[model samples]
Target: MFRPLELFIGLRYTRAKRRNHFISFISLVSMAGIALGVTALIVVISVMNGFDNELRSRILGMVSHATIEGVRDSVKDWESALAKAEKNPHVLGAAPYIEREAMLQGQRVAGGLVRGILPGEEPKVAEIHNKMKSGKLTDLFPGGFGIVLGRELAYKLGVDVGEQVVVYAPEIRATPVGAVPRLKRFTVVGVFEIGMEEYDSGLAIVHMDDARRLYQTDGPDGIRLKLDDMFRAFTVARELAAELGGLYRVRDWMQGHANFFRAIAMEKRVMFMILSLIVAVAAFNLVSTLVMLVTDKQADIAILRTLGASPGTIMGVFMVQGVVVGVIGIAIGTLLGVVLALNLEAIVKFIETKTGLVFLSPDVYYISDLPSDMQWSDVGLIALLGFVFSLLATLYPAWRAARTEPAAALRYE
Candidate 1:
């Protein structure tokens, strides 16, 4: 019954008019500060998560999650290697590949790193085939001497489907006339785009048979595999590699993109730590507000003590008041954060269109657009931390209120 009354009294003192207008303004500002800081932090971290997801889908999606290659020049009994890898419980997909760095030149144009891939097996291992923008992955048939070009590489070479591109393998040798490059002519069969600049600018694909012929290999250079859970790709690769003996070696996506992914994770943590200071300051501001309220209500405190109110009860009153302010601000902030996180890309686009300024550019950033992904766990953690700090901030002020002496304060009055 008295709980509602206590609640009313608690809220009432929070907004009660006081001679110290500056202190009231500071309290209001502190609440707003927490709200803004939380919203901004949620939006930023969500966008970072979005970018991380984009990289996985657009970049990693096109690349192998794990690769099992022979430590020697080429993998022998490639069929056996493929079969053994597929038998693993964790392996979702597997494909044999002969990837070599070679220059592709058409007319006077040249592009780099012509990757030789098997059309049938590639689809099972990587999503690059699904991303073909023009023509078909099957167009790179072994019998046809055809190759697929990366979107940007296609643009740079100024070639399209049905055009001829010269592929210069590492067969260049010194001749009596001059330096000669071992080159072959292949028809461009298709163009693929994964929206990642690196792939588009530096990669090309050909039939694995064609690649083997170019490298003068009897079998595939290596085998690429995808796992049921990509997060476990590294562990699975390690176990499989060990099982297959020393002839085969394994490499996972984590090894290839370790530093980059680590940097993104590190940046996320650093940003959270820095932004949290803002929330900490806002939560701690309750101390000042409660202390000021206690000083203002000294006379009333003395009267309440005379009427036999315990020090504990007095402490509870101010403690509840401070907590109420913190709760209201955190609740509001969490709601705002959710809204911003869900539609962050749209908001950034609208702002950029209205102002004709790009906040993120494809040239500088990986993707052309903003991304946002909000985790409910992050919201809960932030709210819980704010509330805890708020409770901690109230102790000193609440104690000060509880320590008010009835006789001494009334005598002064």
Candidate 2:
């Protein structure tokens, strides 16, 4: 079998001993740099992706994907709106809701938004049933003032299931008794946890009838729609609003947390750009290493040229050598990244247990655990980009090698 002379020579040069220790040193640094950059990028991106995923699945699970509220009155025949919403191709489930903002006065007083829903109908819209920690959803069905509160909220209020908590809706009522505040007493029937500190600390659920009485709406204040695909929520919301015409107005979860999620996306982009450049700088070190190698092999280049080797072939030989180094670094980095991504949670747990420091604290970061989401597509892109930079780094040094004066360089030998 015939082998390409350039490839054979390039492989030889890549493995050959170097006379200049600095050349070897720079080559080592280049490889290490690429490895570090790739590894760090993978880990950080995975964590960011994990956070993004959590926001969608956990946070969104508790909140409505889109709310179609009656701007004119309490969603005229809310049941009919829910039925039609469920029939929409994009919508998976729909439920009627009556929401109110109130303060829970217990051992410790705190304010939060409370949502009233039917226990049986809620599972179709919100995943509240699944998030329950120590109680059942059915508890909310019992006639008078029964409720389910988020675990963190329960803890903060120093109240448990079966305890009475006073709810005060400041904006809902004003009377001669000094702004009556629509005071109501409710028994905590259950506790739920969704891994989001915000939701767990500031959300509660009650019976729709009770909520209707509090909000004074004709029926449900709005219909919550759950879409098959959450990413298309805004589109579906607009379409629904158009479908319902002047009677209803639609709002998506994206609108509710627009700035927060946008900040996260912007942060990820900036982080990827900064980290990718670290790999570029490392790959650029190939120029110095290859330049030194070309000098050391000057006589060989001259001999090969004298023996009829083309300048392009000479350039290919050096270019291939630089690419080989870069490819090796990329492969190692990719493998390391995959391993880390797969085991990031366990690794962090081990470290935290040993050091006694929390990585993600509910008290600080709104999440109580670490998260990782590895995307193979991101890995492929990182590897491809690293290789391209490494190949580009070869041009100057390879061209220098190709331009060696055959007669003059050979004369020295």
Per-model TM-score on C-alpha atoms: 0.90, 0.92
**lDDT for predicted candidate 2 compared with the true structure:** 0.86
Assess the local accuracy of residue 318 in candidate 1 as a C-alpha lDDT between 0 and 100: 89
Clashes of each: 0, 0
In model 1, pairs of residues that clash are none
Candidate 1's displacement at residue 298, Å, is: 0.9
Question: Which digits, one per residue and each the tens of the lDDT, describe model 1 over residues 48-122?
Answer: 788888887786777788988888768878788789889999898898988778877875566578777878888
Write model 2 residue lDDT over 1-413, tens digit each, in one string: 78899999999888888888888888988998888788888888888898888877886888889888887678757776677788799998888888878889888899998888988888887888998988888888746788889988999999998898988876546677665657788998899988787889999899998877766667988888888888788889888878766767778888888898999899989989999999899999899989989998899999999899999999999999999989988888888988998899999999999999887776777667778999999888889989999999999999999999998897868
RMSD of each: 2.8, 2.3
Worst 10 residues of 2 by lDDT: 170-179
Candidate 2 stretches with Cα past 4 Å from truth are 19-22, 171-181, 354-358, 361-365
lDDT of each: 0.83, 0.86
Backbone clash total, candidate 1: 0
